[model samples]
Target: MQRPQTVVFTDLDGTFLDHETYQPGPALEALEELLAVGVAVYFCSAKTRVEQQAIANEFRVDVGFVVENGAAIYATAGAATVFGMPYAQVREALHNAAAACGAAVRGYGDMDVAEVMEHTGLDERRAQYARQREFTESFVIESGEPYELSQAMGELGLRLQRGSRFWTAQGEHDKGMAVRHVTTQLGPNAESFGLGDFDNDLEMLTAVDTPMLVQQHDGTWRDLHVEDMVRLSGIGPVGWCSGAELVLRRHNAR
Candidate 1:
């Protein structure tokens, strides 16, 4: 029997891409090697479809992606498999949740490109891409703990997820669900690897066969306690380099 095809599901902003420069840096070589071997590198990220698709196109990769914190998955065939509410519904739900909890919140739908750039420091092009969201509403709470907000959203059957920069409100579907869906389509010939650097990455990390934590920008790990997890001892894309090489090592051995 043929060996299972390797697949990597990764977070983007502070994992595969450098937080400051937003480039792959040292992970480029390993990414190339993986692609050379036909490994699918699905970018499971908080980014929107436009942003993720731009990256895939820029890198010349044909691998599908999970976008908007698993609100949708793009299969290798270029068909989108959406798993949750539409943008208008999600935005309305967030507003209702915030009002119900009396919490002050500002989501991307409430912000223009200038405001988004101000909050995120993304360039004009990236800011435009961010605004093209379809499923999740990324926001910030100007108030205190999100406990009340979480409860409020939960009442409406939505989940509040925290990313490295923002909190996103979407349906109950998560990265793990999206990854599982993709792998299921790949049948039994799938060996999955996951890499992340923040608390929001917990679901995706736990769903994969090999879960690796990339070092955070502050030189610390994400503090997740996944079983048999590997902590790559480098920061941002530097740690991503370690993870990519490790995946290559395993792939070559197989």
Candidate 2:
């Protein structure tokens, strides 16, 4: 039997983190363990690069990361490379898109980093902690159809990614593309696993050999690809962590 070396990529919110509080549970420990055993851990998130970096720092692991829904890729310890649209173009297109749709646009760089906590109703302590670090530019808009947003972003030479919560301007990037990019950098033979729990995660989940879904309390799992899926009996981060352990155990046995 061939033992496949695995790399794990996870989405942040509504998957690993509690959707309401943004807290990590037992699944976080499983992630650390995976890292200890040399399975690469990467974060593929709708978060801005700044937000992702703060979380990565908390993990104390130099994992590769894909941010802005695949608009940018950052080396664990080096420069961040843009894979989608340039920042300026994304800004302009987002402004126009917001105007057309009567929506508001918020950029990580435009407001004080503290504003995220206020806007999203995140904890103030978390916001303060985040403010202490350098942040990457991220933008959010509330309007436009998914395809329309995608096309306009494309015209600006950037990628628009739609996630569970919001639409963001990163560049022309998606979680699927980010997964492929990281895999390519790690070499072709590395086995990969993807974990997520929402519509935006579909592409990444489909791209990996072992895809896990973090079950939610509202029976959202029923609407996803449940066939052959390894369901976590728990909810939030605990369920995600449970699912990861199961996947790791199964992988090791093979």
In angstroms, how far off is 175's CA in candidate 2?
Answer: 0.9
Instruction: Output the TM-score of candidate 2.
Output: 0.77
Lowest lDDT block of 10, candidate 2: 129-138
* Candidate lDDT (C-alpha), each: 0.88, 0.68
Query: Candidate 2, residues 125-184: lDDT per residue as tens digits?
Result: 665543332222345664445566556555655555544444456544567887887777
Over 4 Å off, model 2: 1-4, 77-81, 96-115, 124-154, 158-165, 217-222, 225-228
Q: What are the root-mean-square deviations of the candidates from the true structure over C-alphas?
A: 1.9, 4.1
Residue-by-residue lDDT tens digits, candidate 1, 1-254: 77778899988888988988888877877787788887888999888889999998887767778998888999778788989799999999888989998999998889999999999888989998999989999999998569999999999988988765788899978889999888888778688999999877898999999999989889988789899899998998889888988888888888
Residue 44, candidate 2: Cα error in Å is 1.2
Model 2 score (lDDT): 0.68
After the best TM-score superposition of candidate 2, give how far the Cα of residue 105 lies from its true spot, in angstroms: 5.1
User: Using Cα atoms with residue i matched to residue i, what is each candidate's TM-score against the true structure?
Assistant: 0.92, 0.77
Residue 169 of model 2 has an lDDT of 63
